[model samples]
Target: MALDFYTNPMSRGQIVRWMLEESGLPYEEKIVAYGPEMKGENYRQINPMGKVPAIVHEGRIVTECAAICVYLAEMAQEADLAPHPDERADYYRWIFFAAGPVEAAVTTRAMGFSPQPDQEVMAGFGNYDLTMSVLEGALSGRDYLCGARFTAADVYVGSQVDWGLTFGTIPSRPAFDTYAARLRDRPAYKRAKARDQALIEAQNQAQGPQN
Candidate 1:
């Protein structure tokens, strides 16, 4: 069987979809809608978390957005999106940074979490100001997360930056603005996004409250 991508376009699955398109790889996408049988017992076998963006490749299952992006990028070597051996350290650095502090901070902000000064360090994301400063510092002098050349790290980190900015969870500073613009310029990103957006809109329509 070919690689199977379990996705719900309204979710983070869009990031994985974009990475797959960039890889120029052929895979089967099985859309899983919320509140469906696919989100129940049967699908839980593939992922106990019952999440939308899981993938089964070569009989191995991968979950988590950042992990999925890195795996597919490395698997589709022809795309040359993985970082060079010498740059692997920085590659892993920014990807994990985005997945960790950046994601936590953005999510907490979106959820209306206001951290007390004393509670800042206790929170997973420290604080919004600190998180933004750290992210901005990382991108201040670099074109990409790993610098100059784009890599799988860019796809993962750029998606976070773009989404965070769009949702107002993060500031749209010059660094984030420039990086997200570069990411949006990719044809693969555009194509993948177009499909997912339509799906998301359809989902909202289907879920709309009726009189």
Candidate 2:
């Protein structure tokens, strides 16, 4: 049976789509429009959070971006995209690290939300500059997050770097540029990205201009 991927081209859903391609797993793609209707009855059954990038595999529902990515990596063990048993610690470390603070900083910048001086302690991401600096430090000397070879961590982290570069949310430092370029050169990444870009253009055309 094929995996079922629920996604939206314009959102974080694109990351999971890329993972599906890299996993070499056949998935049936279902596009969900962004609106309250998606959050209504239907999507809630898949994810109570009404989020995209969820998947249904073998009658089990998996939501959350990183969860789904890790799940798929495990399911396609032959791909060997995930870290080995010994590397598991570092794998989960950077994976969640990217999902947590890195994502927080990126989204906060995208939304134009800044933590005031008094709220800095309470702010999960601290500040964008700090977040980027930390990430650069992590990726500086390592070709991949786990060292020389690419792992599933690259899929997740590379997605962030790719999106950051595209949206100008993350600075294009030498390390980031090299890493994202490497990921982009992958055939699977190219295919998935092209499909999403086409879908986005189609959606825009359909919407046209509204007064």
Candidate 3:
């Protein structure tokens, strides 16, 4: 069976959609609207978390945007989006870094919470500044998260940086600006953005104008 992609255009699913486009693979997308539809039993079967982005491939299910990106890249090895086995350490490292620490730090700040110094030790991200500094250091002189060449890690990390900068969740830094610029130049990224924009516009039109 072809891959089944469950997503909401306005959600983080846009990241996975970009990854799918980068993979050059055919997928059947099921748009699950933001509220009741996403929490419905049918969609819940694919992801108990009732998330916006989930994928069913070859009878197996994958959730989480980062994981989905890695899965698709590895599956479509011909696309050269995944690193070779020997070079995969950085690939896995930064991907999980974005999903874990970076995500936690940004989310906590977005929600208006900051851990105390004593609490930093207990927090997976340490603190927002520390997390951002680590990420900035990683990308400081690098073209991609794994180094010179682009990989699946960039898709996940780049999406985070792109979204972070756009929403002011992450402070804008030189490294982030340069990184996002590179990601925007990719044809696949452009295609994904255009596709999702159309979906967003259509949905808005359906909902009609608000006061």
Candidate 4:
């Protein structure tokens, strides 16, 4: 089965890129720029959401960063990126935790809005402060989410911590710094970053100096 990766170098596609690299899957990369190209009928057929970071594998369309990471992990059995049988509980818990609460909290915070005390009950993350605390506690003493073992959950959850620290959306902490550093040291992460960096540089050069 052909693996078709649709992404823009600047988008969350980087997450899927790292997953793909780790999966050791040879995939066709399709760069869909923002605006018309991404929203065009041709690409929309592939993903109705008209977003980057969607993949077509085994003749099925998979969208969203978290789902893509989990799917690749399961498919790439030889790589063992999926959690071991015993770690399944923590694996699903944190993977969706990152994809849900961590993601919601960070995004809402960055947007300059957080749920009030009463509103917190409605917010799935409760509040940024609580979400951050819980996330930190999850990674505090363990080398990985599943107790010293790295899984696809790390790719999803780790990206949240890594980006949060880098972009200042999530507050900085020693635990986050150390966790992001560990993920940065992975060869797959480095490779995905480098490839995206190259593309960004090329795009910049083509556009020339900006005003």
Number of backbone collisions per candidate, in order? 0, 0, 0, 0
19-113 per-residue lDDT for model 2 (tens digits): 98899998899999888866989889999988798999989999988898899999998888889877788789889989999988888878988
Q: Tens-digit lDDT track for model 3 on 1-211?
A: 4799999899999999999999988999999997788888988999989888999998999999988998898899889998887768989989999999999999999999989999998997899999999999989988997788989899999999999999999888999999999999999999999999999999999999899
CA displacement after TM-score superposition, residue 199 of candidate 3 (Å): 0.4
Evaluated at residue 32, the lDDT of candidate 2 is 90
Poorest stretch of ten by lDDT in candidate 2: 117-126
- Estimate every model's Cα lDDT from 0 to 1: 0.88, 0.88, 0.92, 0.91
After the best TM-score superposition of candidate 2, give how far the Cα of residue 68 lies from its true spot, in angstroms. Answer: 0.7
State the lDDT of candidate 4 residue by residue for 133-185, as single tens digits. Answer: 99989989889999998889888899888888888987888888888999999
- Badly placed stretches (over 4 Å) of model 4 are none
Best by lDDT: 3
Give the Cα-based TM-score of candidate 4 against the true structure: 0.98
| Residue-wise C-alpha lDDT for candidate 1, range 1-211, written one tens digit per residue | 3799999987889889999899888999989877755669888988888787999998999999999999998898989999898889999998999899888888777888868999987877788898899989988888888879888898888888888888787797998898899899999999999988898888879879777
Estimate the TM-score of every prediction: 0.92, 0.93, 0.97, 0.98
How far is each candidate from the true structure, as Cα RMSD in Å? 1.9, 1.7, 0.9, 0.9
Q: How far is candidate 2 from the true structure (C-alpha RMSD, Å)?
A: 1.7
Candidate order, lDDT descending = 3, 4, 2, 1
Of candidates 3 and 2, the better by lDDT: 3
TM-score of 2: 0.93
Q: Which pairs clash in the backbone of model 4?
A: none
lDDT of 3 at 159: 95
List the candidate 3 regions with Cα displacement exceeding 4 Å. none
